[model samples]
Target chain A: MNSFQLEVNIMQIKVLYFARIKEAVNYSSEDVDLPEDIETITALKHWLSKRGEVWANLFSGKLVVRAAINHNLVDDLATFEDGDEVAFFPPVTGG
Target chain B: MIRVQTDDFDMAQVLDDLRKHNPKVGAIVSFVGLVRDINDSAEVTTLTLEHYPEMTQKALQAIVDQAKQRWDIIDAVVIHRVGTLLPTDQIVLVAISSAHRQAAFSACEFVMDYLKTQAPFWKKETNSQGARWVEAKASDDEAQARWTQ
Candidate 1:
């Protein structure tokens, strides 16, 4: 009966929070369980928003939040692979 | 060269190291960003700069590479400081060396302009009133747009 499973799926992704986002979340990083319905960066945010009020408030304004996948800036439409590193941060203010 | 560190940098030393044995460099242009005492009319007392480590290095390298591709500069150096800093402290440096002044000047400005808009660094200013994160201004975007084709 166990042989009926045809594939193994990644159950989690590494998530990083930086700068203001880090302060807001009160943690720098975490291992986020990849929800069965989450397939894209936008979906990932929607999943994270369910974590708590702080997360909901932070992700609710998606316009101000910027994302990077595997160290490169990415749009919401970007796809994520299992074990990929995803970072969420506010817009840069450095020179 | 692109560097991100918490220590202060010596401008003269960086400029000297840039042109070292290369006599082809006839002109050197540089710009330094300093921590100001006032921002958005707040009496800023201190400034803290934060960056995304590996991502910051990559972004800065990409910026300098773009400048090199667009200009005929001999070499460029970017040194940015992080962590806590006081007013009037040096925060960043952009220097370019070239056989002529125009190329060096243009490339140096180009790198700094891109750094302001594209680099993954965040600045928080602590004024007498309170601590606040600095907002990215539209003027910075306009400054970078001027160089685009």
Candidate 2:
């Protein structure tokens, strides 16, 4: 096994999908083992887009997705750590 | 106070509670958002509200905190209801109290404007045609922006 591939399962992060993004992806939340090179929010978006066509549209800016780390909003360049909780959703519409 | 729940809230009781807590308050401004029967040029029957549960409360508190810092408000109360709701159902209530009416009114508006654009809750309306997610408006962003200027 490639050493880099072996490191993949070591870091686990929780990803939450909300609202429209949840309906499109058919998942409310999931646990994803980070790929060795997927370290930042932008990198994670690009990597997840490769999953398939629907995933691509959801993450490739077709939907204006927002990200948050541990309940706080963060920009695309924000880095992730093991066990971090990340959320993605469209812009809010509540008052 | 920030609350997210499925139970319908009593606006009268909520305001009375605020008044009780701050006896010195001279003014209270409250805004109640209701599920409307018409939306986006369609006749709506029911509305569903969804949110990131953990983040929703945190975001609301942060908005209230910002309002507190920006105005001479005594306190803020925010209650948002989720799950299935019918037309005319109360969806949210934002109330602020202060020593003066000017402070109360301004802070109330500031909290509401920020909540419209910043809170994590999303609303979906079901009309005769079907259900659709409420789209974010450029006008909402503009509403939030005016506070800074």
lDDT of 1 by residue, B1-149 (tens): 88999999999999998778999999999999999888753788999998889688888998999998988999999999999999999999999999999999999999988899888899999977788888888899889999986
Please report the candidate that would top DockQ against the real structure. Answer: 2
Predicted model with the maximum lDDT: 2
After superposition, candidate 2 runs with Cα above 4 Å error = A2-4, A7-10
**Candidate number of the best TM-score:** 2
> Model 2 TM-score?
0.94
TM-score of chain A of each: 0.84, 0.89
**Residue-level lDDT tens digits of model 1 in A11-68:** 6888998888999989999997774568688888888898898889989765488888
Candidate 2 displacement at residue B76 in angstroms: 1.0
For model 2, the docking class works out as high
